[model samples]
Target: MAGFHVLTGSGSTIAHPKVRRIGVSDILDAMRSGLADFWDRPSHYVFLCLIYPVIGMILLTWASTGNALQLIFPLVAGFALLGPLAAIGLYEISRRRERGEDASWRYAFEVVKSPAIPSILAVGAMLMAIFLVWIFTAQALYAWLYGPTAPDALIGFIYEVLTTRQGWTLLLVGNFVGLLFALVVLSTTSVAFPMLLDRDVGAYAAVATSARVMLTNPLPILLWGLMVAALLVIGTIPLLVGLAVIFPILGHATWHLYRKTVVAPPERKRRR
Candidate 1:
């Protein structure tokens, strides 16, 4: 299979990185690798992974307000749009572990000191902008359909959503819009963050490379996205407590996926 080639600049020079075409097997392999990484020293991830449950709690708190009930689903679903940013540290840990180095939780913070922090933050800002847009769009859709006031109770709201035309319309249209946003995030960040961490490529190149990865292996990338979404939903089912495990596995898996998709640059030959 032909690989997708991305031309990225590293300061004074350019590098052509090849993104290999992957398959379902590769996805499974990556997941297994991720699981192994997580199990290696699961304790190392305990503190590092708490951020997810914290965010989940915050979202739940916000959604508890009667007026904000309409935002419950949107807030939870749209959180996935920022998953790449949340996993930056996990990627660093996986990177270190792969190199047989210290993979302690504290070392994950080392990404803060990386030269690519600017690029990583740039991409994170872009995802945050998209997440905000998704939230506003979902809110507008609900307001247009059901008016500004929420149903008096949670049960009544659920009943109306299942039985009423306006409710059905809101569900369909809102989810469709959310899916579009999700796909955009998946395509743009599938390998962008990890690439930035592993290379000197600027934000533009990293994003371009990620876009190419999606274009070249759309099926595999989409499958990977679905897997991530499914795992997230499972994690959310137990009152967000499951995320401590799910989040780390997914984060590590993403780094492994990046490794499988992108060919590492060749080592430079030094003159004797």
Candidate 2:
């Protein structure tokens, strides 16, 4: 089915893409296509995504010292919330390649010049707000269970978490809370970013469309979310270095997934 291009009061055309219900196989195909895109220029993606692991390492160091030790898990887990923002450039790269255009790494920054940048930044801000709230919620959850005082060192905190009842409770409740946040991020953002890239729809409409996609195809979207979480865990295991590969693949995959989930606006016919 074709989507609509609605003219607004200000005469701006807003594309409301039609949503499609997808399946497990579609998700797999998207990832496969994404990996192929990454392999087309692995070095470029690596250079683009190196900042991910560096940021992870910084968060690890920050959490390892002082009272921030308790934040290590939260910092790592919170990556799901912010990962989409990090991948905006990758989406552009994939989109360019798909259209048979030049997809050099520098072109990734072309998003900065897009008319949709403001909307993209608005959505990005919303994600940042969620990330901040998640961090605060993580801290509050820990404080409620074990008080404001963090352990003297990383190992001591590890012992407290592994050997104590409150630690067990924290792990259970904290992960449960984190899951809720991840789901919200997944439902709202799975298609939003890429849709924004492909269309000039406002942030509100893009987010609404993404949520609609989630409702229309819950199982596949949730499965994709779980897969992303699993891969991110593996990526972080090698001291966060693996994300140099993992993030780009997921990033490129997300663009392909968006293509599968949303129908693009029809082309305009030229008059004879």
Candidate 3:
């Protein structure tokens, strides 16, 4: 039998016969599958997410001793480094499901056990670099506005300007910059790791393909990106406790999204 090919909505081919284009319903189904798997193996999921608060508290405690703004550095670094590792568990689960195999904690670890570790770590390093740049920019802006030492008289003046028309405008500009940064990295790397795991493709190809997928399905991808952002924001509310569920669900859903997007090359026909 000829292998089936998954294609884009425009009929451009995507994945191999083993992988198919999943619909919105498939996304929901995958989420359900992920939730079921989570409940069945709650300990594994909980353990991974627990790192968030432990790290958050440690940073917060240190920040309390100094300027609160200092905590942002460590917090961003922690999320950048540890977040992907936590999501690896769900990636494994999704991989097993894709192969019609049992989804178990063992399968989750199997996802992390890859010769592609160095490549994934390299991708992680690139992400960290981008994040650090943003952090430094924000820090520089904050320092410029407040300064290392300012008189009490300057406080009123700064407050007036900060709350005025120009302040709002600057705020908007700052937010737009942050949003663009988030979107660029988010869209580029959303399916990056999963793609690497699913295929023998290099990390560069995985990241590039993920960006192409976003460009091809801009609106849907934008909505998906916003959903992830909102969820991550909410997950941070309860001292980061919500991450246990949110991270896993997002990770599994991402795998499904990836399955929906990229196509594998067509297999050559065999002579009869």
Candidate 4:
């Protein structure tokens, strides 16, 4: 994970963030390094984590009073899709700390002014689209399996899903569909987000580069995906507060992964 293994394969309009084969160790290392960055400014990540709960509280209010219980799971999964955007700030923090420079959260916001803004915004839109699709698909799956109406009581709904035979079907189908969407989001955004931040490249090129990274390192990439999913689920266990640490760690880890896996585009030799 420390040194680069430059990939010769090409994928986009311009391959600025050169691809490389990565292994399990690299992923873990990146995550560990990410955790290190989170501690570098724990207050910032705490702020990020707290902000997420207000939305969840609103959703909880809706679920308590309405039939919108189906929306909850997707919102959780959507966190992974949206992590790239959220991590932009963390990426900057990590970038600065790496260079022994000032690690300012406000400075991280300046990433928007980078020339990569168009590409970053484009990828952000793609993540948002996937999140919306996941939400609708989740709701549709619920309606198909358990009818459009959820139980008036949250405890009753949980009991039904856990104890009924139809509930098993719902879990099976819902997880299967969710896995499909997760793979799509993971493949496209895994390296693309960090790559865009580190390089000057078009959005399509950045996406293509990320796809190539997964293609070259399939098992490890899938492992990383599962880790993110697991972290999100675990973080939700404690009133969504654990996410304050976990989210930033993952974001910082992503930056490390990008540095480890992507070889910079080689400089063209000047003509004699």
Tens-digit per-residue lDDT, 1-272, candidate 4: 10111111122335545578888999999888988888877896778656666565666666566767766666676656788777787787777787788886776676876656677787888899998998888888888887877667667777888899887888888889989998998888788877766665667767887788888889999999899889988877887777777778888998998888778656722111
lDDT of 3 by residue, 131-170 (tens): 7677666555545655654223434544644788744654
Model 4 regions lying over 4 Å from their true place: 1-13, 267-272
lDDT (0 to 1) per candidate = 0.84, 0.86, 0.61, 0.75
Candidate 1 structure quality by residue, lDDT tens digits, 1-272: 00111223346434457899999999999999999999988977866797888887898687876468778888889888999999999999898888888888888888988766777887888999999999999988988987888666777888889899988998899889989999999989999888888886767778888898999999999999999999999988998888899999999999999999998878732111
Task: Name the better of 1 and 2 by lDDT.
Answer: 2
Q: lDDT score of model 2?
A: 0.86
Indicate which candidate wins on lDDT. 2
Error of 4 at 84 (Å): 1.7
Report backbone clashes per prediction: 0, 0, 4, 0
Q: How far off is residue 163 in model 3, in Å?
A: 5.8
RMSD of 1: 5.0
Between which residue pairs do clashes occur in model 4? none
Q: State the displacement of the C-alpha of residue 263, model 2, in Å, after optimal TM-score superposition.
A: 0.8
Q: Which should have the higher lDDT, number 2 or number 3?
A: 2
TM-score of each: 0.92, 0.93, 0.73, 0.88
> For model 1, what is the alpha-carbon lDDT of residue 222?
93
Q: How many backbone overlaps does candidate 3 show?
A: 4
